[model samples]
Target: MIRLAVVGVGKMGLSHLSILGAHPQVRIEAVCDTSGYLLDVLGKYTGVTGYSDYEKMLERADLDAVVIATPTRAHATMVRAALERGLHVFCEKPLTLRSEDSEALARLAEERGLHCQVGYHNRFVAAFSEVKRLLELGAIGEVTHALAEAYGPVVLRPKGGTWRSRSAEGGGCLYDYAAHPLDLLAWYLGEPRAVGGTVMGRIFSADTEDEVYSTLFYPGGASAQLSVNWSDESFRKMTTRITLTGTAGRIVVDRQECQVYLRDTAVPPEGYHHGWNVRYTTELTPPVWFYLRGEEYSAEWAYFVDAVAGEPADGAAAGVNSFASAAVTDRVIEMLVADAAVPCGVAAASGTGASGAGVSGAAGAGPGSRGARKRAFWSLGKLRGE
Candidate 1:
């Protein structure tokens, strides 16, 4: 069995614990958290040891790998400690608040010859995976533009203060929510060369932004737009959608389905037609041993475990969700943060009109002079932790 330890017993941490515990190839060697009460409760139920100190658990558990679900600020330190002790690591998204730290961790993992998977579970979603496959096969030809959006009711109110509202703790809709779509964009298209026309707004949260809008320009002239909001009550839960426009066709993907539209009568892949085709995720998603929010969660852990067990000393299999990939996503975040710093009027004056001129106004607002001023002021603040 692959012995494992889990740090941080918060929401995402507990989810990882449950899935890892259920895996037949894994043994829950220990769990760590600051809350004694939480440790006691989980220890009693899982029959696993618990510790208030992660270092103590690391010393005693004899673990082969660790899953880190701690707050953003704690990731670099915790991951460094675990890697130093020769443990494979599965860290949640935004591997670190900064790209340099993520690069350091990636290099460390390479030097140690250990598996390091970042938790961008959206990549494991069946439809998204299939979309990747199609893109690789040139299903839509050379991508010219793309759009990614995510919305949810995560921070509907400002009263219930949590770490998510504070930028220092990795709170904020940008890192916590928009990171998903941003990562998806980078994965589908190439890394962005430049970013401009950003809008970050606070609808409810006192400190963190509740909404984000940005435009990204890729090396090959392909461009992307990202829109995310955690204060949208219309979304019962988090919803992610991506649209890619290419030379030959276009593809659209949401949680439930992936739809493709071909501009010409070109031959298509199996289960797809030339004019228009739709594939439901229910028909495409693979089964997992356990399911929580989505099968992708369990699937990502399973992939990480397999990589830990089977990866060669060269660490080739680590590329799928590797820290390297997370670092690239971190770079995109860095660009977005930088773009948000520019004055809205300055961006528009430079011809980088919000999300491309005539495509969409900032945050669904019109091009009115008053709206432009509001958008400019809103985009000025730095993302808290950055």
Candidate 2:
């Protein structure tokens, strides 16, 4: 059995703990949290050792791996410590607030030859996975443009006291919410070379943005538009949707279904055909032992467990959610921040002349030219609390 520990028993952390604890091949060794009361409360139900300090737990518990669901800021430190002790790691998304730190941690995991996975659970969703397969099979045919969007009622009021409201801590909507669709876009389409037309707006959060809109330009002239909002009550919970437009057809995917529309008759994979076709996720996804929130959560954990056991089947697809993949998402976050730094007026003015050089210069100003804006955007919520 793989002896495992969990750090930071928050919402996501608890979810990981539930799935990992239920895995027959896993033994719940220990759990750590900054709150002694929380540790006490959880220890009673889990029947596992608990510690208030992560380092103490690491030193005392005999563990083969750790699942980290700490805040974005603490991810780098916790991951480094886990990797230093030769433990496999499963960390939540937005691996780190900065791209450089994410790159460094990725390198550390690679040098140690450890299996590290990020919490991009969407990739495991049947509909999303099917979309990836279709794209690989050229179902859409040279995707020219894509739209990725996520909306939910997460923070409708001012979250002045929460870490999520602080950019330095949780990275606002871009890292917390938009990361999902952005990661999906990067996975389907290649990494974006440049990002522009960025806008971050604070609809509810006192500091961090609750809505983010941007455009990503890929290498082969392909482009993607991203829109995310955590304050949209129209969605009962977080809902992500992707629409891809290609030379021959278009594909749309959401939690429940995958729909394809072909302009001209074309051969598609089995169960799909020309004209308009729809496939429900229930038909394409395999069964899972347990289901909570979504089957993807359990599916991802199953994959991680198999990866830890050195199972060849999972090893082949191990890199699907590896840290290296997350690092690319981090880079996109960086690009968005840089793009947001450019003044709205400047962007508008550059677009007026329609000169390539003028627009490029405006977009190239990046984070270096407007670091203060980025800082202010991240710190506004925290400052409100102070």
Candidate 3:
């Protein structure tokens, strides 16, 4: 069994521990966290050893791999340390707040030939995975454009002044929530050429952003738009949807319920049924739909474990999530942070009227496009089961 060490006793870290501890292929060797009190409590409950310092834990634990769910700012340093020690790593999302740091880690992993999995959990969901498969088979027919939006009540920090309130910790609504939708978009299309957006912190006294609206442009006229906000008091919604109008057909995905509709042929014919039918083509049978099943996080963590076990990577069609997805996300955050002065509900001051034109260039180019090939290559590898 692979001996797994969990560094960070936060909510996510605990989730990782629970998930990993139960995996047949893994043994929860040790747990580390800055909070000695929390770790001690968890240790007593689980009968697992604990450490206050991650590095100290790493030094003493007989571990084959480490899962890093520390605060966002610490991701780079912690992941690098684990990888440098030749330990496979399963790190939480936004590998680093800065694109350069994330890129560096990606390079380091390549040089070390160590497995590194970044958390982009949605792609592992059965419904989202099915969408990935359909996109790979050209079910969406060369996606030309898409949109993703997520909205919910503002995030109030459980602690008043934690790292999550700082920009350095990647603590922004977009950074926290948009990553999923952005990753999904990249997976469906490709990376944007140039991305610009507005990020604002209007709803609360929080030090970071609460809202963002971004657009991404890809080659061959494909484009995508993403809007996210924590300022809304509306019903909580986490949607990774896409409306693809290809040369042949169209496909739409509602990630929350794993529902999809495809109109490949005609719209269910224009005629009515016999017998019990009262009307003719009144409903038109709608479009052919498919439903997906399974928990997203379970599938994602399971994949990470498999990758750590030497399974080939196949995340390309899914748009090299992990660090690559984080890169684009970072760019969006960059735009948001750069234009933070703009009110949460207002567009950038310029208001050129490109409809969130601030965030979209062309695909396969620009800083936002940083690791597309790596992402795509791994995706192809996955498709070939390499």
Candidate 4:
């Protein structure tokens, strides 16, 4: 069994605890959180030890891996501490508030030979996973454009908020919501060369954005648009979808299903016709030992457990959403945040050509350029008033 410690016990954290507690190959070693009341309750019922101090927990617990579901601000420190203890880590999305930190953490984990995955669980979702498979199979030949969108009812009214509503904490709509589609975009396409026309709109929240809109330009002339709004009441829950247009056909996939349309000249994959076809998620999703909000939840944990156990079975094929991949997404988020701060108007006024200011400079830098990695520092410094 992979002895694991679960940190944080909030909404997403509690969900992870419940799912992982039922995992057949996992033994819950301990849980750590700041809330003693929540910890005491979990201990009384679940029979797992609990701790209020994270450092204390790390010092005493027998752990092979740690699943960290803390706030974005807490991730870098917590993950680094756990890695120093030589424990594998599964952290939540937007690995850290900054791409540089996420990249550094990725390198640290690699040096220690530990598995460090991020909770971009959309990668485990059947429809989204199918999209990746199809793209790999060239079912949609040479993707030309993609539109990734997400909508939910998160911040609809003005009120005092938790860490989620604060830009310095949870990163608001752009990080909390937009990161999902952004990660998927990076997974399907490579790192974006540049970001443009990024907009962060504040509908209800005073501190951070409620809606996010941006465009990502890729190296091969392909492009993607991101549209995310957390203030939409029409969605009963968060709904993320992606539309891909390629040379041969187009694919539209959401949590529920994948829709495909192919031109007459394109050759269809097996079981797919040379026209419109639909595949439900149930058919594509492999069965899980336990079910929760969705199979993807258990599926991701299962993948992590297998990886930690050093058993490369079917799980290895899907590929874990490693910290490395999350870094790519994080850098893209930084570019978006920097782009939203100052768009083409500011860039044009500053004689920086009209793409944007800092982001345009970042875009102009080669993907591997030092400027690309260091350009966002100025915008972040400006955001922090440093």
Indicate the residue-level lDDT of 357 in model 4.
46
Models 1 onward score TM values of 0.88, 0.89, 0.75, 0.89
Q: Residues 33-86, candidate 2, lDDT per residue (tens digit)?
A: 888888888878768899888888889999999999888999999999999999
Preferred candidate (TM-score higher): 3 or 4? 4
lDDT of 4 at 101: 90
Model 3 TM-score (2 dp): 0.75
Clashing pairs in 4: none
Ranked by lDDT, the better of candidates 1 and 3 is 1
Expressed as tens digits, the lDDT of each residue in 49-73 for candidate 4 is 9999999999999899898998899
Model 3 lDDT tens row, 1-386: 78899888787787777777767778999998888798779878988999988888889999989998888888888988888899988888867777767778878887888777777776665455656665667643567767777777656333347665666676767677777777777667765554443435445635766667766667788877777776676646454455556554555555543333444442222231211112211121122112122255555666666677776654532323555455555554454344343222223446547665442223455323434434443443342334
lDDT of 1 by residue, 1-386 (tens): 89998898899998998888899999998999999999889878878899999888888889899999988999999999999999999998889998889999999999999989999988888888778888987888899999999999888776546777798888899999999998888788867766777889999888888999988888878899899999999999999999999988999998789999977745587777778889888998878899988988987887888778884422212367789999989887876776676544423444655654432245536453456545543442333232
Q: Which stretch of 10 consecutive residues in model 2 shows the poorest summed lDDT?
A: 377-386
Model 3 poorest 10 in a row by lDDT: 272-281
RMSD of each: 6.1, 6.3, 10.0, 6.0
Question: TM-score of the candidate numbered 2?
Answer: 0.89
Candidate 3 Cα misplacement greater than 4 A, ranges: 154-159, 197-201, 237-240, 258-294, 311-328, 335-386
Better of 1 and 4 by TM-score: 4
lDDT, residue 140, model 3 = 38
